[model samples]
Target: MSTVSTHVLDTALGRPAQGVPVRLSWITDDEVVVLGTGSTDDDGRVTELAPDGLEFGTYQLWFGVAAYAITSGQSIFFPEVTVTFQINDERHYHVPLLLSPFAYSTYRGS
Candidate 1:
């Protein structure tokens, strides 16, 4: 089984983005099923979105940025960010997001 985690960093502020809402979803050919939901901790980390286990397939991590924008008082262009990835093995997946007001980037982390 596979597991998932995530971290959010505010590039514009050069700090961790706390209190950002996050959701995990399992994607199928027909529909997307939400598996878990959480908000980033003070360290800007969702340690384990899927504490239970996951199968080898496609999944999505949805981050709600509007809350952060409101709290930080930053004008953000993207209110939400979605990252879709595939899990093909029994390993841990860390998807980290580097975010700013206008742009964001993600990568497969350790």
Candidate 2:
């Protein structure tokens, strides 16, 4: 079976970006044939996505970080960051984000 997860760390705050609402879905119908979504936890992580597992397809993640920044008195130049990736096999996809108000980065994690 395949699975997906993510951990978001606020680089500017030096802590996890807690309470952020993140979702994983097919960006467009042409992107994939199905839909999936999930939210972040206190640890700045999405522990489980694709409960039924995943197959070879393209996927997009809608990560909302604006609320957290606003509550922290920070300014988010990029209100949200969307990551698009592909699942090639039955393995765990850990997409991690190193975030900041004005800058952010993501990569294929463990």
Local lDDT at 94 for model 2: 94
What is the Å distance of residue 82 in model 1 from its true position?
0.4
* Model 1, residue 11: C-alpha shift (Å): 0.9
Top-scoring candidate (lDDT): 1
- Candidate 2 has a TM-score of 0.88
> Candidate 2, residues 12-71: lDDT per residue as tens digits?
889888877778775456554435666667788888666777767778777877877876
Best candidate per TM-score, number? 1
Model 1, which residues run further than 4 Å from truth? none
TM-score to true structure, per model: 0.97, 0.88
Worst 10 residues of 1 by lDDT: 45-54
| Alpha-carbon local distance difference test for all models | 0.96, 0.80
Backbone clash tally for model 1? 0
